[model samples]
Target chain A: MPPTSEPSTSDTAQPTDADALQAEVTRLRELVGPDEAAYTSLKIELWAARDSAFGAEMAAGELRGQVKVLEGQLAQANRNRRWMVERIKAPLRRVKAILR
Target chain B: MARYSILTPVYDPPEDVLRACLESVARQTFQDWEHCLVDDASTQPHVARVLEEYAAKDRRFKVKRRAANGGIIAASQDALELATGEFVCLLDHDDLLTKDALFEVDLIASTDPSLDYCYSDEDYLSPDGKFINPFHKPDWSPERFRSQMYTGHFSVARRDLVIEVGGFRTGYEGSQDYDLVLRVTEKARSVRHVAKILYHWRMMPESVAQNAEAKPWAYEAGRRAVQDHCDRTGRRATVVDGVVPGVYRVQREIEGEPLVSVVIPTRGSSARVWGVERCFIVEAVRSLVERARYTNIEIIVVMDAPAPAGVIEKLERLAGDRLKIVWYDKPFNFSEKVNLGAAHASGELMLVLNDDIEVETPDFIETMIGLIQEGDVAMVGAKLLFADGRLQHAGHLYNHDPFHAYFGYPANHLGESSVLACQRETSGVTAACALVKMSIWNEVGGLTPELAANFNDVDLSLKIRAKGYRILWTPYAVLYHFESMTRIPTVNLDELKVMRERWATPLKNDPYHNPNFEPLRDDWVLRSR
Candidate 1:
């Protein structure tokens, strides 16, 4: 009774700091829920986004590979066209037969 | 006793020549040889009497008279078909063989059991039986035989191979022997040349060389023979001029080291100092020096005026002792400058390089030199291309139609231009980057300074042809040429006038110059054009 004669402002501020800490703890508990279904749904959405991005990348790579193959085929066709014109078709039809 | 069936086709041969040939056959040391004489409907009574007498007297000799004249080639074929000996020998009724001809041939064949054919040297004789000159040949190596058939040795071949080739083509009479030899050599397991005089070739007045009228057909026959040989061997055969009487073989050897001299003639433009041209020279020289498999070379830079001090210093520092500067302060003449450079060359092969041109490959010199090393080739030209990789020159041809001129064509064509590009006997080459034999250059007296810058190469080529040497073009040897870089002002009025005058003189004066510019005339192009 002799030591606690007057009430101090520090005792009132100490309870307010405790109240703010309790509110932060309540918000953190809401973010990290104890329910398994909510956590699993969020994890599935993130995984789907990552999988879609990876699939898009793989499709682009396949398209590039196909373009290179087509270019090679086009070049070969041009060569064959020139060869047939100069060596085969023209020689057979236009030029006088060498046998004669 | 090994018997040789000698096939002789008679077509109104001179009485004295026929008798002499018959006497030679009668006097042969090898008595086992038989004669199969086919009379191809001779018009002369003396030929019939002589043939009848020989047939009646000797059982070894048989005469078959064709119902109608099928020509000399057909008669020879008929005689070849009738022959029943281990070896077949061909003899024209007008030519004589030595007494020991069969004996020597038999000895060579017997010694080498693998021998499919044997040939001996011959003496070219005049109609009066006077010796003109002896064509002594070297002993056979397959390489030498493939290089040139020097001995018109009147070869003795196996009968089966003769029959297999269908005897001989009728139209190839003048070169029937050549065609037969080429065919037999292709199939022959072994071939040997007896280095002795065993046959006599009669040089009659009516023969191809002596008679002006008979030459054209004879040349055509000779060309056909070359074509046939090329077909049979699966190798390209070019009909080049011969050092001797027969067709010169153009054989390519891929595996030998070549000695080369690179000649650069300069008048010292800014191009020589520092730029695209300088870079070209540096890169070409460096590539040749550093990367070439062929190590032996000498770089000759022929200068008309003194080069810039800076340029000289640069060349000295870069090349050190490998570069040799040949100074020519003479008049402005391209041919004279080249002659001056050639005079100082030490290599067995000489390359005339325009300083303006850059070599595309390190193997350019090697490829050009390889084509000419086949013994009979006098000169070779490389394929010239522009910086953009289009052809600048394949070879040269002369045109006399509108005016006397020289032209090159198929400027950017990728493949060969003509048969000449694949395998042909060309008229000449542009001297821009020509590879030639030093000996042949000396023999032909270099280039004429009068023609100088224009038609000088054509003049040199004509001289080579006159002496019976072939000028060749090789696609494998490639270079990039900024054409006529040294002739500055881009175009000179004085130079054009001079070139025209110079070209006209050679066109007028050269006797060997194709009258209709036939050298430049391509049959294929003519048909298309």
Candidate 2:
């Protein structure tokens, strides 16, 4: 209020980078409020979004590893099944008692 | 018209038993037969009544009741004294003769005019007159006859031969008939067999031969008879102890130390390789070279295919001068592989072994060879065990399954612990380990290649049995086996199918792969127990 400066054509045409950044920060602060609780909640929301993205990739990798282990177990099960069938197919002993 | 004198010694036999015996004699095809019934002062009235009735009905039947109650041997001799026929046949009052009994004897005497003595095969009947078993006799030979007397023979011999041998001896009471037969055969110009079923031996609970109870006296008499015959014939006969029936020992000097060729057929696989574990062949051969009790030994390794280069190199490094390799570039056929190996052996005895086994005892070869040298033993098998220390095979039971087949069981365990340990004579041993005389092997024609991988041992055992030789499974000889360790990764369906088919078909056809094994009937196992 001490001295009001007229707006320059360059400043009016496009906002400066530093001025834009500061304006966005002020807008966020106004929406959330200036209290410590609001500030802590805002920080937690940003951290949660980043953590969720990383957790999705890790979960997908773990699922792939489990799938590989399960496939190996299935192959082993089939081999054992075949071996059991073969053993059963062997002929049983024949016994003949002499007519005494 | 040749007259047949039937000498029957009667004790206090039941009326029914005596009637059956007389009826059987009456039914004989040869009508001109005379029966001498010597009664040993029967305490039972039924015996006299039956004998009197039979004597009155038939003119050919004669009765002689003893004044004193003499034993069976004296009564039998009394009957023999009354015999007036050219040929005499010994028959017990409790036993019976088949309808064609006399006809069979007449046929044999007429054909073999020079034959002075003859015997026939017999069948056993229960007291209730039910047929039990047929005791088939092999063709007659002097060596076979002297080695073992299988048939009681309801025999027909020239009267002079019986009299010259002093009929039946008193000392040989229970086995008097055996003693007399041995003496008659010795004195005879010719001895023969009818090879026909002409007699029915009734089995009574108290009968010496029929009863399973101990008859040490009878066995001793039989042993004496064998010894006396040998002494008379100037043949050195040593009673073979620790052997089963149908086995004998003959004294003969070793002509020369015969070289023994050991043949081992192997596939480089870990399962069938004879000495893969603890390097069996390598170690066994090394031991044989280092501590052999016998001087002459040769080791031959027959590979179905070239082993892995590493295995071959190791074997070559261990073989030294005693080992020979015969590469067989062919499919896996155990019998054929053995035959191929035998064809190349330069020894009198062939020792066959499996790849996955190792000889645990050093005296194994010597023990088997020594037994074979005693004569009569055709083949010897080592006791085989599994890696887990259970019996894999001791010997085989012939006709174990009624299908004329044999099987090995309880692999890698102690044989003496098996239920069949009581059976001393085995049908055959697993080809995995066996020592066989090359002479007998050649005479019997080695293993049947048609059997291929399975049951080849049974076929070989049967062939040896057919030659009147015994198959012995020695427990003293031991070997360790790792069974089926190198089996193919996949099951061979075709081989399996063929194995079963071959097993079933031969059993159906032969019904007795080993004639020594009595065919399975319901009563056999029960009676034995």
Candidate 3:
């Protein structure tokens, strides 16, 4: 709170290098503004990539489930076709035996 | 408080076996252990008397009796429930542990409290209590464990994980230990192997260890165990009985008919063989084409032309249309020759075979291809025998030395010893007759040309393993490898230095070789250090 004398002309002319450096840093900051928006957009891009991978994994799992079901159905259909062929042949063989 | 609870279930075990088992536990140097003896309603009065005597003598001994004849699984579960220790080890009543078994387990548990599971090396005990046939096991090898329960006996697990995996399954009685081990290892946070023979599995005539016929159910259960393991892990494989009893063969089916490229790098020279002047390449090619059952293979023979004159023409004549001869005009580099041959190879699978090798098994290609067909496995090697019929290359291992575990025993050696008798996971196998996936070969950038001779295969194996691929050694794929028949041996110190520098850590410590063992010997001897 003590009031000091104002800087003499000589003292003001020879400013400390640190003060000059700080002034240059502030001027550069003013020119470039802030990188906060760029970083936020970068975070958003990374999250989007993660979500895309997760969605692909889910889709692949669902497709595999559907394939497994289809395979089971095909196996059942093949078994039924074999059974029908055997059933048709069974009567035919019996009739032929009777004729003989 | 006790740190380890040993669960040993006794049925109608022989009195001597039961006494020996109990005596081993009683004589433990580590006092912080509880022997949880569960009697599965033994009809023999002596078994119960022995259990009661142990319980009365030692406060650390806990005994429980099943109402009916509950199998080993139920008895194990009952003993697990009775356990108050941090970790529990399963012991068979007929087996004996080394005096330091409990001490070793306690040491690891106390030192590294984070370890969830641990196993020790084991051997077999004859009926007369003579310890023999010690299995000096490797460190924690998940790939090897998947093929067979290499860490079967003296396996200790944290009590919480054991209880969480539901102690033991009901129907996997004969192979209850295998089932429990599979479950425990699946849920394990960390696994450790003591690398010392701390357990001795006794073999009685009626015991499953001695005779598979004693309980056919055990083999069936083992098959189911491996199949279930495959199912659980989603490793698409078909499990079947191996050539040996109590061992299972896991055959992985290939997607389609993949062409196999057989690259036999040789120097086309005529040498006197058993008083007959003949070219080895001619006969080797003939042997391969005539013997190998798999017909879908193309032979790529790389040879230096000027060294042997007309030998190339003779090889080409014998090889016929299937042969692709690459003239290796440059100085001899085994690694470069193989790489050059690989570049010319058209098959999906590349078999780096030596020209001196005579294919023994008709199903050599079929067997090796079946193994490498698994997506996880990168390569599979064969059991090679010398010209005189002694073993040459059972499986190649970097036992800190350039080589170890290659027993050139008698031609008619009993196929019982641990090393060559069964199919197992190995760190590296000699490229002499190794079948590797071409994609994997490309991935690891083929053999290191800088390592032209000595450790080219080892460097390639380490590189392949670095890519998270496993290598296997199978005895089923047998071949007679007349090792280095045409090639003159020379050691370049520069190449050796490159090898040592490239694999400094692995050279110092091989995962396939036990830490207790010295680098020069396959036999597990306590290292001086």
**Count of steric clashes across candidates, in order:** 0, 28, 0
Give the winner by lDDT: 2 or 3: 3
Tens-digit lDDT string for candidate 2 (B1-529): 2379999999998888899899999898888789999999999999888888989998788899998888989999999888899899988887889889988888878777677888887778876668766655543444334445554757888988899889978998677887888888877887766655678888887765476344657766666777777677665445442233332333323446789998888766543222223454555555556655666878888875657656665666566666788889977788888988898898989888887765667677775675566467788787775543335566654343422111222332211112122213455667778889998888877877666766677677767876777776665576766674235435345644644564554333332122332344211121110
How big is the RMSD of model 1? 24.4
For candidate 2, what is the TM-score? 0.57
Q: How displaced is residue A59 in candidate 2, in Å?
A: 52
Residue B513, candidate 2: how far off, in angstroms? 6.6
Pick out the ten consecutive residues of candidate 2 chain A with the lowest summed lDDT: A91-100
Off by over 4 Å in 2: A1-100, B1-3, B14-16, B40-53, B64-70, B84-87, B104-149, B153-167, B181-205, B227-257, B272-295, B303-322, B326-340, B356-406, B409-529
Give the candidates in order of lDDT, highest first: 3, 2, 1
**Model 1 lDDT, residue A13, Cα:** 57
How accurate is chain B of model 3, given as a TM-score from 0 to 1? 0.83
- DockQ for the candidates, in order: 0.01, 0.01, 0.00
lDDT (Cα atoms) of all candidates against the true structure: 0.66, 0.67, 0.78
Candidate 1, residues B426-520: lDDT per residue as tens digits? Answer: 55777888888899999999988776666677778778867877777665577777653234334345545655554554443322122321233
